[model samples]
Target chain A: MSTSFLHSFQSEWLKTRRSLAAWLVIIGGFFLPFIMLVGRTVYHEKTSAESTSPLFWENLAGQCWQFMALFLLPMGVILATSLITQIEFRNNAWKQVHTTPQHFYTLFWSKLMVIMVMVVQFFILFNIGIYLAGAVPALLLGTVDYPSQPFPFMYMLKTSGRFMLDILPVVGLQYLISLQFKNFFVPLGVGIAMLMLSLVMVEWKYGYIVPYTYSPYNFFELRGSAMSGSKDVNIHWLALSYFAFFTVLSFVLYISKKEKG
Target chain B: MHTIEAIGLTHHFSKEIPVLENIEMRVREGSIYGFLGPNGAGKTTTLRLMLGLLRKQGGEISIFGKPFEKHRTELLSNIGSLIESPTVYGHLTATENLTVWQKAYRCPKNRIPEALRLVGLHGTGIKKAHQFSLGMKQRLGIAAALLHQPSLLVLDEPTNGLDPGGIIEIREMLRNLNREEGVTILISSHLLPEIEKLATDVGIIHRGKMLFQGSLASLLLRQHQASRIAIETSDNAAALQLLAGNGLDPRIEAGCINLAAAEKPAIADINRKLVQHGLDVYRIATVEDDLETIFMNLTNQ
Candidate 1:
């Protein structure tokens, strides 16, 4: 990147401090793991019995993904993306940024990069939370011995990386919609409505077309459920394609807009 | 040389509704030019077009002798603007807000404190901009515009909602910037008296057309030419005849004998002649036209 573009990116990153998106990342990351930790401590006998299984770590990860992929990750992306994009609109600062020395591409890509980086930061926090959720129970309950199975660092990272890819289309679509409208509820409402539609169409033959369904469908497939639509199709590639399409379309529309503010 | 020049600028929201028409404006270097217009006279739109905030649908804008569209980024490095209301990030403190622009402008970090001090906001410390009073927020906006130390400053209605004291403060600051820093300023307002106080050059725009553009002295000269004298005497018909007979070209208008292009000395001479003609001059008032009256006359035309 050019120095000016890098500077624009740095400015965009600093703008997110104390923002709602920042809070969403922190709170969303710890939410599920904290719940899991609480549930295991309250029901130690069940957790202790479950820990004896050889797939203990894998089972715990699956449980986390059950909530995350179906709801938490998608909702987190929707809210965080909208909040970040709304910063300029909320403060009435879009015209201000446009008049700056930075180019149109710099403003567009820098803000998008900050949102994407925040998503990555969210994933890192979630992974650390997952580790704590699994380990805290083993430490707190004498009846629950540490799981005999080794920590699945590689498996956890691989699964987290896949989940990140699965949700990119959500981030892209939400960012695009958010940038177009000043009303926060508009994008949030669209995301919620699409997510519901995606859930209803998950079993349909062409459910892969709705990018929102990728997370839930990927989770169900990983849990050994029968893949809907074509059995040989890879939804990750579909997810990536949808992400690229929305990203490019939004960029074109944004820079060409006559009255950006 | 001119710091900014716009030629044949025209814009319309729709084919049937034109906002600006064939407008030409020249803002010279090291001069404070006040852009004057009533509400909806296309002042803000013209300023937006000059700064490239809105796409120019017609005509050319050049700043520092280069085409605005082809050399926008380079020209913008030396142009700072505050359009309409102040744009302040509610979540960030005053310092943080300037820091954001400091990074974008790639200016020295030290300029941030200097800018804050320039705007009397250095003492604000950690107060977020949303909490600032309207005047303070406007100040902070000006400070942000000055952060890059641009040679040209474009401000739209900078004194729109400021209290008298606040207006005075901003006026003095603009004067100092023009005098000390040699920064050219193009500030717009509907208030002629306000512009009369600060503007070295003035442009009066009305209904999407440039009515008058020149130095304040030339506009005052136009005001001088437009001045009139009004006389009410005991015998109004006889007084009109007597003044006209004396080659004063006086006529009755709105129940008074009026003379066009009358000067201060003409007021005394006309009064003395009326008394000598056995007509009691009840009142003789020299209506010296002000800038506001001149603005009204031009806009009315």
Candidate 2:
């Protein structure tokens, strides 16, 4: 079983080695931080504030990743899930892959694993983007007002680490969506729509039911509820619970469901 | 031993319209079993069910002498299939597409070349699958299916996009695969003439039901039984009246007079009698019933 799982994993990895979507994930990681750098530079050039604070780096790290939880990360998960599985659907390869000696469960889990690894790749590249965008401008201007001080490695790790834990359910949800729909754009459109709805839903008392909002609610609250000022979300328990629940549910349905040629 | 057997197989895409029902099919070992049908005859659906591509609601499929469900993965390792359309990775090159399946089936690396060569697509360099023509794409799909050297090959409309030469090439290859490699093949084709040339055993289906399942000889025998003699002249109506008056039992169909006869001698005698009566016989020939006619008789056509 392990050998079979490995084979499926290798097959998927090889398939996506030069994939455009995988490159998009890498490009997206750099997207937010670089934009932030451009924004801060414009802000400084337009209005050079007299007060210089060391906490500028701290605030930049906090705001960028918080924005990630709110928007970019969720979209990234959706794109990765959709793009990775699009190959199977586009080629109508589900039947071919399923009819092989490897079980669907193994292939299903391997897909989930590939998506997670890609998310991690984004996280690592995102951190690099933040560090360079923060330091490059600061080192040139020699200003303590902008993000110019020592890189906040620990702070960024703790913040993004919370995101990784909190977004597990979104991964599971998107995996199921990609496999269930034959149309390539359905999962992507649904994910984006769900994220938009989750933004509105987060204000309601039952917003915790929406997996898309978990990452934002968790990371902002990672400074603990006393400091961040949100009280209605169950961060770890719901995500982990959703992950475990959907993994089994999707597996059973996926195996029993007829694969389209 | 049979390579594949479907016992009372049935399927439906929707509750209102049944796709296939009570389909009993068997593919014997080491023979090319042609699943003959017209367009939308549920040929692809039945093949999908046998491969476990579709869920079987009310049936049992046994392959390699055991229940397909009980040992699906083990049984699948020996089966190779290309159903409905060609499946090729547009992002990858020709070689890379074969490599992907080669990894999945865990076949030897060298089999890739042999399969590629068999399909007449070797030595094409740096051409991604998206660049391939329709015929090239079909060839690549076949190469991938053969990459693993499967014991049974399930191909649905394998010659849909191929040129005449490519079609004949595939025919000869399938024949060689059956005769030399002893591979059991269950191929589906809507064209009766194409299947007639390649298949040893045939199963005719229409509107999702089995019409006939037997040998090629049996099909030919039915064709022989359907033979008739067509009498043509400048004035078909005159020839028709003449044949009818002479007790030849002629029926006018498609601008000619047709008489039911099992042999050429009867047709000649009719022609000679027509000439003797001063009725012009422009042409007189035995119309041996073709496989297409036999297929049309079996199905709605």
Candidate 3:
């Protein structure tokens, strides 16, 4: 990277420290896993018997993602992206950043890169949480037998990778809208509205066009509960396409905007 | 040499209303240029255009003898500005706020405390900007602007909300920056007295037009022209006619025959002429024009 770009990125990175966006990442990453750990401990008798099944690890992963793919991940993306983009607006600092020596490209992309990196951090934390949730039961309670089936490391990694791709369009669009409006609610409202619309149209044949449905549908398909129509569409490729289109559109609009602040 | 020059700058929000029209401004190197204007007179717009915060609708802006648009990033590296309000992050301390810009300006981190010290914010340790008073926030904003040590400083109403002491502190700081460090400044404010106290040069803008632009001495020269000598005469009507008839412009203002501030010899000549015309010149006194009056006259014109 150029020195200017590196500096811009570093500056943006510092802004996220102790911010609402940072808190959201920490809390959002661990909330569901913490709940699962409690749930498994509360009902160890039923879980210990099911632990011997060959599908034990897969079932546990599926259960963890059911609500996550449906709401938490999508909502987390919306909140995190909006919170990060709104930092400049909240403090009335856009003109300050614009007047600096950095190029517009550096300013725009460095912010987007920070949000993306935070998302990666969230995923890493969530994965660690997931591992602890699965392993802590066997380690602490003698009554609970460790799952006889080998841990599906490759399957888990692949699922996490797919979920990351599946959520990119939501991130791209949220980042775009958040950059345009100063009121935090506008982007947050638009994201929630779009996610709701996608959920409503999930059974429609062309529902794959709505990028927000990609994550949830991917989860349902993996769990064999997907509607037959979803099998015909490659949601991942569509998500990638939508992500690229929105991201480029955002870049053009932002750099060309006359009144940035 | 001119540190900043704007020629024929024009902008309009709609076709019906132009915010700036055919503006011609120049800021000499090492000189403090006070951009004097009232509210909604496009002072902020012109500054925004110069700083590239607003896209120029027409004309050209050049700083340091180069086109602003073509050399924006390079030019901005040597230009520090605070437009309208202080844009400090309320979440960060003064030092951290300066560090943010230091990284962006690619300046050394040690310059942070130096800048804070210059703005008298060096002692604000770990206090978030939101916790600071409005004056303190404004100072932090200036410290951030000064972090890169730009050669030219463009401030739009840097003292808008400052108290008397805060205003004096800013004025002194700016004066020292110009006299000692040689930083050219283009500061905008509607406070005529404030500008009068600190500006080496003044540019009075009103209703989107360049009404006057020159040295403080030249602007004060117009202040003399704007001032009037009021005469209480026995026949004020006759005195008005007598002064106008002698190739002098005089008018009745507040029941007194008023003539533009003139040389001592001219005042004597007027006195003799009025007395010769059978008019008793009861009293002759100079009505000193304040800076606001001069500003009003220029902008109103």
Candidate 4:
């Protein structure tokens, strides 16, 4: 990290400590996987008719991904960005920050960097949570050949890892919207509206190209087949393209934008 | 050296009327310079321009004997500002909020307690700022601004949201900082009397133009020496017409009528003329003008 970026990150990180918004990322990470565990247990209890179910983990994992992709991930990004930036907006601290020695570039990008670090931390904990959510419970129930099958560990890991790549660009978009508005509800409303729009248009042939719907397609369409532990950049190149375009535009606008009353 | 010098500052938002035009202000080092103006008289705009929060379009600003824009980064490290509303992190404790700025300003940790104590909030332990009253918040804002011990403190209406006692506390604190620490303060206020007791130098701005900028002692000399005759009348229009018909220029203000010339002969004579015109002359008194009257005379004109 450059000194300017480091200085900004230090301030950003200090503000995040014990902040409610920053904790939401951890809660969201833990809560989503914990819900999946409950769903799996209920599914396992209802399946006495079949001798054994092959689709037990698959269906549960699929549902978890669908929820994460469509609603939870997008909403998490929205809330996190707004609440994080809202700390500055809440008491009108932007003037002090503006008058500081820190340049707009360092301040803007450093915030993005903090959000990126937070998202990565969330993704890692989420991956570990989901893995334990399935593997630990399955072992206790003697439901399936756990040690013999060794628990599709790589599949769970890859899917969670894929969630990061696909979801990060989503975070970038929310950061742009969140930083522009001092009112938290404006960006939050826009985020929810876009998420709803993404869900409505997910079935269109070219819908995956839409940035909001990209995660749903990537998670749902690719969760089943693309879990082959293969690298495919084309899966989210469009989301990445949008992320890069907006990130640049956001930086330009932020650096050049003169503050006003 | 002038701590802050804004020469020919011209600013406009879009093609609208210029908010500040050709404003040249000078603040001497170690002097509490009051940027005095009525509401919407561009007091806030001029302070923002001085702090480089607003872009300088047509003028040069010098701070600490150097061009402001050129040495902004280095100069900002030596300056602290609270513009309009106080900037505070409400979620954190008072100590924690100061800690956040200590890192930003790279000041030592001991200064946090010193600042809080200076603001009369030293013992409020672990209380988050969200629960603080408005006066406490304003004090905390001042504490945060004072955290780095800047050479020049630029505050825009710092006493706002503070009560009478809180206002005095801040006024005393600013004076102490100026006297003991030699910290130069540039404060903006719409109320002349409020700044009258604090500022060493005063700049009266009205309608984006500076009406007067000089030492407070000099301004006060003009204020105290100003003598005006005020007449309370039953019918102000009749009294004004009577005074005008008698070659006296009497101006009506609020309910009382005032004449620029104040003398015992003038006071006795206006009373007689009003009665001759069948106007009821209530009480007429010759009183010394106050700072508010001086400011009104300077800015209202």
Best prediction by DockQ: 1
**Rank order (by DockQ, best first):** 1, 3, 2, 4
- For each candidate in turn, the TM-score is 0.96, 0.87, 0.93, 0.84
Distance from true location, Cα of A140 in model 3, Å: 5.5
Tell me the number of clashing residue pairs for each predicted model: 0, 0, 0, 0
**Per-residue lDDT of model 3, residues A1-261, tens digit only:** 887888999999988878899999998988888898888888999878877999887888888888889999999999999999999999999999999998899999999999999999988788777777777888889999888888888888888888988999999999999999999999999999998998888888878877899998899888888865478988888889999999999999998999865
Query: Residue B240 in model 2: shift from native, Å?
Result: 7.6
lDDT of 4: 0.79
Every model's DockQ: 0.80, 0.54, 0.75, 0.43
Collision pairs in model 4: none
Model 1 residue A203 CA deviation in Å: 0.8
Per-residue lDDT over B140-165 for candidate 3, one digit per residue giving the tens place of the 0 to 100 score: 88888888989999998998678888
The CAPRI quality class of candidate 1 comes to: medium
lDDT string, candidate 4, B1-301, tens digits: 8988889999897778988889999999999999999899999988888877787788889999999888877898899888988777877888888887887776789999999999988987978888898888889889988998999999999999999988988999899999999999999998787898899999999998988999999987787567777888889987787788777788988788888755677677777778877788777877678888888888878
What is the two-chain DockQ of model 4? Answer: 0.43
* Highest TM-score scorer: 1
- Cα error, residue B258 of model 2, in Å, equals 3.5
